[model samples]
Target: MNDVTQPVSRTVGILAGMGPAAGVDFVRLFVAACESWLREHGHPVLDQSYPEHWMAQLPVPDRTLALSDASAEQPLDAMARGLRQLASLGATAIAIPCNTAHAWHAALQERVPEVELLHIASETATDVERRGLARVALLATEGTYGAGLYGHAFDALGIQCLLPDQAARKRLMQGIYDGVKAGDLALAQQCFTEVGEQLRAQHGDIALVMACTEIPLALPQAPAARGWTLIDPTAILANALARRAYARA
Candidate 1:
């Protein structure tokens, strides 16, 4: 008689709703990443082969608003609650899709020490480094810029990050809040395109890192955006989470 072994199982958690749409988009990316993993590992694409996962689309406070205004209700508590909820539900590893929300990543990780909380900026920086890119432009919310989330990560990898000017940054924020968040793709496309063009003109044709999850929704559609190399941090983080879920024990 041959000995049989049980397949290892893991649960992936997504703490989202920073913006409802971005959260939904991350789910699609995760599924795609899982499919890629299946092909790479030579595993059959059976329903049972996928890892169990749960997403909590909690109505958390606005991360960008919280970060910019001290008086605004901080997202730490709400995010922590969400994290705890997922951990309690048997989530072995977790990923938060919002870039601005990652500002509270350390605190959230501390609250749920048992679960593996993937860092979006760290994973993105690793991907950028692996691509041998020396410089990149960042298009993100003012909160992410002020927090220096991607700045610190890229700096650690010795990758220079080109930032938009004050006006350009404001435009990018409007693109996120007024455009994508408001369900106006036309406005979002214009704002993202203007910023992308400005950054490209100022620094060369380097890769533009869509550090904000919302940016990817419209940036790809910009006409001028076609000439630039776009890096999707959300996708990078999703792939990282996928690898974690499928890692051999």
Candidate 2:
């Protein structure tokens, strides 16, 4: 008789719902990543081959509003509650798909110190560095910019992080709040394309970092976005999460 050993499974948690659409998108990306990981490990792509994962799509306060105004509702307590719930459920690795929500990452990490909380900006920065690109344009919410999430990560690699001018930044914000979050993807397409064009015209054919999870939904196929490389932080983060969840003991 031959002895057989079962493959070990690890749990990955997704703390999402800063906006429902982005959370759903992250799950799709994560599943695709898991399939890729299975193939790389020489395993058949079966449903049982996938890792155990849980998604807590809770309604947290607006991250941008919380960051921009002191009087606005804060997201920390709500976010902390979600993290505790996931941890209690045996999630050993976690990913937060919302970029703006990362402004509270430190506090959240402190809350769940035992879990591996993936950092989207750090993953994106590592991807960018691996591609050997030295300059990239960032498109994100005002809150992400204010927190210097990508900027701090890219700075360590000596990458030049280009940002939109004030007016263009406002346009980006309008696209995020009124367009994607409000279920108006057409408006988001327009706003994001214009900003991409403006940045490309100013900097000339550089890569555009879709730092906000919502930006990729509207910007990827825009005609004006032709001839530019789009760096998707969410996708990079998903890949990172897969690598962590599937690591050999």
Across residues 33-119, which tens digit of lDDT does each residue of candidate 1 receive? 998888776776767777888999999989988887899988899899989999999888999999999898898999999999999
Native-vs-model 1 lDDT? 0.90
Can you tell me which runs of candidate 1 are displaced by over 4 Å?
1-7
Per residue, candidate 2 scores C-alpha lDDT tens digits across 16-63 of 997889999999999999999878777777777788889999999999
Give the clash count for each candidate: 0, 0
Cand. 2 TM to true fold: 0.96
lDDT of 2 at 131: 99
Error of 2 at 23 (Å): 0.3
Q: Which ten residues in a row have the lowest lDDT in candidate 2?
A: 1-10
